[model samples]
Target: MKIGIEAQRIFRANKHGMDFVVLETIRELQKIDQKNEYYIFVSPGEDKCLEESKNFHIIEINCPTYPLWEQIAFPRIVSKVKLDLLHCTSNTAPLYCKVPLILTLHDIIFLEPKQNDNKSWYQNMGRFYRRIIVPRILPHCKKIITVSYFERNRIQQTLQLPEEQIIAIYNGYSKHFKKIKEPREITSKYIQAKEYLFFLGNTDPKKNTPRTLKAYSLYLKYSDKKLPLLIADLKEDIINDILRKQKIEEIKPYLFYPGYIPNKDLPYLYNGAFAFLYTSLRESFGIPMLEAMACGTPVITSNTSAMPEIAGEGGILITPTSEEEIANIILELEKNSNFYQQQVAYGLQRVQNFSWKNTAQSLLNLYRQTVTS
Candidate 1:
C-alpha cells in the first residue's frame, strides 16, 4: 500500500499537539509497515524530518496550512500525490480529495461557539473552517481517528459522524517518559529539586489557567504546608502576576522560566514533583496526566470528559470549574501520605493500557480496511 501522509505540522511546530501526533505515529508506522511505500507531504518552509528509507519518502508541497489554503491548495497536493490513501493528522484536511482520506480530529474546540470566546477576524475565519466546513465534509472521509473516546463522541455528536467511522486511538508517551533520576544539576537551578507541585500547559481559556491560579491561591491560603508551585511558560501575564502576588516566587537558587523542558527531562520533572496539577476544563485526552502517571507522579485532574477515563482508578479527579474542589483535592494529596502512595501505584497501572504501538496498529488496520472497501 502506498500511503501519502500530510506531515506539514511535524516540521513547523515548536510545541504543538498535532506535531507530536504526526511525528510519533509516522516513526512507529515506519517500523511496523516496512513493505508499504510511504510519502510524507510537508509545506514549503517545513523541512522533511524523516530519512529516506526502504519504503518512505518526503515530498515538500508548497501551501499554507490555514484559511483558504487548506481548503483550496491541500486537495491539489493530495491529488498530485496520487496515493492509495491520504491521512491528515490535523482537522484541516481538504474538503474534496480524489483519494480516500483519513483525518485525525484531535478536538472539536471550535465547533462549540461558546468556546471561541472573543477572537480576531483571522482566528474566527479558522474557526469557521473547523466549525462549518469540516463537519459538512466529515461524511466524505473514509475514516476518522480521535485521540480519546470523549473526542470520538464529540466529533460524532457535533458533526453527526457515524460512530463506527470514528476510531478512538489513545495518545501515547515518548519512550523517555518512564521514571528517571532527577537531574539535580539541571533541576536544582529551576525548582527545589522535589518540593513543588507542577502545572504545564498553555494559559488559554479552555485550559482553565485563571481558575488554576485561583485554586493555587486558595490552596496556599488554606493549606498549612508552604509548598511551592511550579508553572512553566504560561503566556498570560495576568495569571502570572496573580501567582507572583500570591508569593509563588522563583526557586531562589535557580533561574526561573524553565522554558520548554525537553522530552528526555519530562520524566525527571514528573517524578521529582510533589504532584502534577491538571485543571483543563475539557480534554479529549490529557497527555500530561498520562506522562505523570508513567512517571508514577500522583495526579490531580478534572472529573469531566476523558479525564476520568484516562485517570483510571488512579489520580485525584476534581471539579476543575470549582477552585474549592481543586484546593480540597490538593490539600488531601499533600496531607495524606498513604493516599498519595496509593494514587502513585494506581497511576502506574493505569498507564499500562496506552501504547503507541497499539495506536499505530489500530490506525494501520483501519487504513487497510479503508483501502479494501
Candidate 2:
C-alpha cells in the first residue's frame, strides 16, 4: 500500500505535541514495516530530523501561508502521489483531497466551553481554520484517531460520530527520556539553584499559566523549602504579565525562565527537577506527564480531562482550577519523602505501558484495514 502522512510541521525548529507524535510514529513505522511505500509531507524547516529509508520518502511542500500550503499545495502533491490513504497527523486536513483520509484529532478543546479569556492572533486563526475544516472533513475521513479515550468520547458526542468511528490511540514519549546521569550540568545552565520545580508552559490559555503561578506563590508562602520554578517555552514578559495579573509578583525571585529547551535536553531537565508540574485545564493526552514519568521524575498534574487517565495512580492529581489544591500537593510532595518516592516508582512503572512502537503498530493496522475496506 502507498500511504501519505501529513506531517506539515515535523521539521520545524520549534515543535509541539502533534509534530512530535507524527515524527515518532513515522520513525517507528520505518522500523516495523518494510513492504508498504510511505510518503511524509512536510513544510520547509531548519531541522532535517527524519531520514528516508527504502520504503519511506520525505517530500517537502512549500507555500507562503498555512491555508494555501495545506489546501492548495498539499492536495496538488497528494493528487500526483495518488496514495491509497493519507493520514492527516494534525487536526485539520485538506478539505478536497481525493485520497481516503485518517485524521488524528488530538483534542476538541476549541469546541469546549470557554474557560479563559486568553487569545492570540495565531491561536485564533488556527482555531478558526479547525472550526471550518473539521466538520467538513469528518464525513470524508475513513477513520478518526484521537490521543485519549476521554477525547474520543468527547469527539464522538460533540461530532455525533459512532464510538467505532473514532478510536483512541495514546501518545508515547521518546525512548531518550530517561534518568540523566549528570543532571547538574544541564540544570546549572538554566538556573542557579540545584533543585527546582519544572513546568512547560506557553501563551496557550488551556495551559492555566496564571493559575499555576498563583499556586506556586501559595506554595512559597506556606512551605519553608521554597523551591524555585523553571518554566520552559514561555517568554519573560509573558511570565511577568501573568505574575502581575495574578498578584503574585513577589514570587518572581523564585521563578526562572529557561527560554526554550531542545527535545534532546528535556530528559535531563526532568531528571534534575524536584517535581514536574502540569496543571492544564483540559488536555486530550498529557504527553509531558509521561515524559517526566519516563525520566523517573514525580509529576503533579490535574484531575480533569485525560490527566488522571494518563497519569493513573502514578502522579499527584489536583484540581486545576484551585490554586490551593495545587499548592497543597506541592507541600505534600516536598514534606513527605515516602509519598514522593512512591509517585516516582509508580511513574517509572507506568511509562513502560506506552511506546511509539506500539502506537505505530496500531496505526499500521488501521491503515491496512482502511485501505482494504
Clashes of 1: 1
Error of 1 at 326 (Å): 0.9
**Residue-wise lDDT of candidate 1 within 308-372, one digit each (tens)?**
88887556888988988998888988789999899989988888888778778888898899999
- Choose the strongest candidate by TM-score: 2
Assess every candidate by TM-score.
0.89, 0.98
Tens-place lDDT per residue, model 2, 129-201, is: 8888888999888899999999998999988997788899988989999887888887788888888999999
Assess the local accuracy of residue 36 in candidate 1 as a C-alpha lDDT between 0 and 100: 82
**Residue pairs with backbone overlap in model 1:** 189-254
lDDT of 2: 0.91
User: Over 4 Å off in model 2, which ranges?
Assistant: none
Runs in model 1 deviating more than 4 A are 44-49, 115-125, 236-260
CA lDDT of 54 in candidate 2? 99
lDDT of 1: 0.75
Backbone collisions counted per model? 1, 0
Cα displacement (Å) at residue 325, model 2: 0.9
